[model samples]
Target: MTETTPYDADRARFTRQAPARLVLCDHAVDVADGAAGLVATEHDPDARPGGRVSQAVQLLELTERALVSAVIYERERGSSWAEITQYLGIGPAEAEKRFAAKLAGWDTAFDVPYRLDDTGRKRIPQLPTAAYDPAWACTQLDRWAGNRLILVDNEHPVSSGLVMAVPKT
Candidate 1:
């Protein structure tokens, strides 16, 4: 037999004067029974940019890397370094040199022919997706949720995944 909940009396007395409501991130919550129409807004006021760096900044860097990596794959798949580098908002020549080296390193390590940089031919390497499409990841941040950190999708790796605050219930 299952034990009875002691709040049986309150269960019968439960009656909400208004529809259930929720306040999302950075929003104010109206207290259902606070004195005189009480409303309160909460925030993560004290930010500890601790550990020598904040997670917010770290996440941004990771996203940028993921974007670069995805662009590299796109280049290997036929996109041009000129186009990709321009899209990445980097100085064409400088970014080209930097990215070419990165892709070549990946190719040598993986023994794949995706990168042709050593041949003086600029091309993309079929790296194992060292990063993900940054734009796709950024879309998920269109909304502000709670301060709690949570992964948006588990199956997708962090390079391809997203992180956001928990939704306020």
Candidate 2:
């Protein structure tokens, strides 16, 4: 008989959570809501007819960003090109060709974590904010999963078992 450890339990929970694509889509919806809120506050409903079109265009950018992030997250989690391609309805080579540059950049960020800004004062992180600070990402994602997923234990973070190098603060 095998006994399951707490880590195993958490890993199981993490695996049960939605795939990266669905999670990213949920995030895109949240971003769209926020953008809509900003547009609503900044102008009247009838102020500009073209504003709606522009907002829709802007949301496309958010979707693109989310896609890239989802790819990065899945890759980091040890997902194979074949596995990812199945969801995208593309060949593994095509998927790799499309995302290779972004994956290279993500890998390179670890070598040089930050760069000086134009002012040569403030430091800007090269990695995506979530990648740069995985502990925080884990916390946030876990909380979101606990709230959104059914039968998840709120006390245990779903992503706690993920292997991430947390930067020392």
Candidate 3:
């Protein structure tokens, strides 16, 4: 017999009540780039080498989420599974099996938007927090990258040349 967690129960009970929002490729790339910048460099003294392993593990998780966001963005833009699978070094069938659930959740979030918490008062977005509020994600990620990665033009925003994918209102 399988044990069902509270999370599973709550997920099943969610209701769709809002318009769908688009998750953009540029924002997802920014998230990955900003996270990569967080990896400590040899010249950075503030980083404690003792905790490097744990920090790297955390960054790995962040990178994986960013990749998921990128895939979702690509799928929304009409990219074929074959094209995406080429980059992952996996067959299309396996790639679809791995990501289909996440892609479904992304689609569902635009319809449901949020669900009530245990208290039945709070609204928790079904979408990943970064994808749910892309403007904030862009601002925070831009700040993170700008602080760590040096650019030739200080005036240029880290997200320059990237177009935001906003849903038509």
**What TM-score should be assigned to candidate 1?**
0.36
- Candidate ranking (TM-score, best to worst): 3, 2, 1
Report RMSD for candidate 2.
9.6
TM-score of each: 0.36, 0.61, 0.62
- Residue 16, candidate 3: how far off, in angstroms? 17
Which residue pairs in model 3 clash with each other?
none
- The lDDT-based order of candidates, best leading, equals 2, 3, 1
Cα shift from native, residue 104, model 2 (Å)? 0.9
Query: Candidate 3 — what's its lDDT?
Result: 0.59
Model 3, TM vs. native: 0.62
Encode model 3's per-residue lDDT on 1-169: one tens digit a residue.
Answer: 1333234333332222111122443444555665666664874576567556656676777677767777776677568999998899999899899999998988776656577789976777776655555545446556665666576355435445344444435
- Model 3 stretches with alpha carbons more than 4 Å out: 1-51, 152-169
